[model samples]
Target: MLLMFLSRFRVLISGLSIALFIVLYGFFSMRYVPLSIPWLRLVDFSFWILSLGSCLAGFLDLYLFWRKSPLISTLLITIIGLSITFFARLLSVFYSLLMTSFSIQILGGSLIDKESFVITTGAVAGSFLILGSTSIHTIYKEPIIFLKSSTLYDLMNTLRNTPIVYGSVRELSNDYYIIH
Candidate 1:
């Protein structure tokens, strides 16, 4: 039952993420204006907006559904999302430096330019958030059954008498024995 619920929730998140991305992309693309600083370019602001929305969705999911400390899980997930963005930016800088030092040439001379850097960073962060929020790690917990005294004794006796058992024993809550 819980698995089914979570599976549906994941699908809902995926749909919402796509919808949000589309809206943000349209808004940013239409209102984009060239700025002096390349880093502040809003041409692809949709990606950043999508990434942030994903992270916020993930945080809310964790905080609401998480069985442990909701606050801690929410905080940790948020921090991890931010850290991913930070790492991606740092890696882009390193990549730029390496490209300048080496003679590696692709379609263009500069690979990790400012525009690509923002796009890549936002994409990575957004992907992480979407995945983390939708994917759940859950421990299977068995339900406990309360059996009457006579039924319990008979069940135990039958098990004790059956010596050569080739299969595992599973007791149903009701008083029915299914033999194969």
Candidate 2:
């Protein structure tokens, strides 16, 4: 029931909400003295929207995975990486932290300008987009080949069918499976 509702209305709601945000952002950015809001506030709100959308998409991806559709995860992650490229243009705390942590300077000079930042962002995002996508495609194509379990193979034979997947674990040990 819930899935049906979501399937029918999700796209409509998402489109409307994004449109509403753009409209509100433009309205707030206008030079009208009485209605104007801070640019930083608008940016913060937009970031929150992106974060929330990514999280919800993650949850939906998990549900879809159980239904034997694992492709959504890769698509969502790629989209998220692309969004980060756009957001990196802003002078946000995350961008500052990355720049400071990595010591990214302009050709060994002190100043870091916009062009260098944009180039670095694009390079990193593009590399991940390419490599990450191929890896995800491989994993989805044949998950069990990587699991490497003869016992799992025997169990599948006993059941007379091979399951589509058995996902990764944190570590290969008895301790890793303990709840506490």
lDDT per model, in order? 0.45, 0.39
Query: Which stretch of 10 consecutive residues in model 2 shows the poorest summed lDDT?
Result: 105-114
What is the C-alpha lDDT profile of model 1 across 1-180, one tens digit per residue?
665454445435544665776775556545653332222334234444444445555544444443333233323453465456545544544575586675533222323456545534555554465455345322222111123233324445566765543465444336545343
TM-score of each: 0.34, 0.36
Task: Report how far residue 11 has shifted in candidate 1, in Å.
Answer: 6.3
Model 1 RMSD to the real structure? 15.7
Count of clashing pairs, candidate 1: 0
Question: How many angstroms is residue 175 displaced in model 1 relative to the true structure, after the best TM-score fit?
Answer: 42
lDDT of 2 at 4: 42
> Once model 2 is optimally superposed onto the true structure by TM-score, how far is the C-alpha of residue 41 displaced, in angstroms?
1.7
**Best by the TM-score measure:** 2
Residue range 7-68, candidate 2, lDDT tens digits: 33333333343455456556655733322234434434543444334333333333333334
